[model samples]
Target: MAFSADELRVLRRALALALHPAPLPADEVRECLQLAGSVDEAIREAGRLRAFLLADLARYRTALPGSATGYLELLQDALAAGYRPQPDDLASLRSLRHLPLAAALLARCQGIAERSVRARLARSTAGPSGAAVPAAPAPRTRLTALPGGRADIKPARPAVPGKPAPADDPAKDRPVPTPAEAFPPRKRPVPPGERREAS
Candidate 1:
């Protein structure tokens, strides 16, 4: 963003006044405000131009083989403006290497993109010191010792298919005999009838 000689003067004066406090003349204050507004407008214009360039770059990048020349120019411009190439950009550039400019960009961008990938891979697989970190152990499936192992001293019993399971005793449900039923009382002799005595 190039500032005109008059705008630069206004900005310089504004800064000088800030450092050395003084009552500003109304005209000078107005000039400073105008310069600030122009700066803001310039910033907004730059942003819009960047967005437009990126959009054009992406369009050309996709239609490669057809838009090789335009894509190469736009890519160089974007790279000059500090736009980092993405993985997709690298892939597209790879196919366009038949062109000299496309080949140059492909070489440059592949190095950067590959380095980024390698950095990510290193971070994922290693610790801060760069040593290979051990992965967590998987959970064991069998909780008890395996059969026939020294850890299991007792042999496992096999199921007998022909043998029936033992049932509860039926005598448990029968009632016990009472004491009166266990013994019988003795019978007494009967006396002579009163009618026989009278005869």
Candidate 2:
């Protein structure tokens, strides 16, 4: 069924929810499927199929970028060739059949277009007043733990040249073992006292 722009948006949002597996309220579900009605079973089936497709798509993008690209190309071709969707077709389409088969296809395209427009607007506005806007930082993917099972962080700074750093903490600003406080002297047994000498 050819969906209007608004129907496309709702269907896309519902598909995104399903792909992500977020908790769907009863009212939300009712609202989502309201346009489908009881007769258009193809639309509902396509919606379910689209859910699985997008879920796999999300994973494929990260796991196999090249394969994901190939998948999209294949999906486009399949859609062009009358990709009639049969939802819950577990064997053939475990999580992917065609992208444009669902009513949300236009919405998917709109989302991408909207994102691009927003990105361009952000860049254009990034001059004097846009300083208040905070852009998402790029991902920094690296191993959390370093070699030898230690934290992956900067190395401890070496003591500056010529000035030996205190092995103990310098914060205390006092030596632990002062030379004045010496250990007890060895005990020596005195011979017969001077009284014996006077005798």
Give lDDT tens digits, candidate 1, residues 1-199: 7889998899899899889989999999999999989989988998899999999998997787788888889988988887879877888887877778778899988777788889888789997898867788656787765677756444444657898644334544767567766766666655668557766
lDDT, candidate 2, 74-159, per-residue tens: 44543454443223222223334354343244344445456667887987768586663556775788756656656543455688
Off by over 4 Å in 1: 110-199
Per-candidate TM vs. native?
0.54, 0.22
lDDT of 1 at 80: 84
TM-score of 2: 0.22
lDDT of 1 at 45: 93
Question: For model 2, what is the alpha-carbon lDDT of residue 188?
Answer: 83
> Residue 67 CA error for candidate 1 (Å)?
0.8
Best by lDDT: 1
Model 2 poorest 10 in a row by lDDT:
84-93
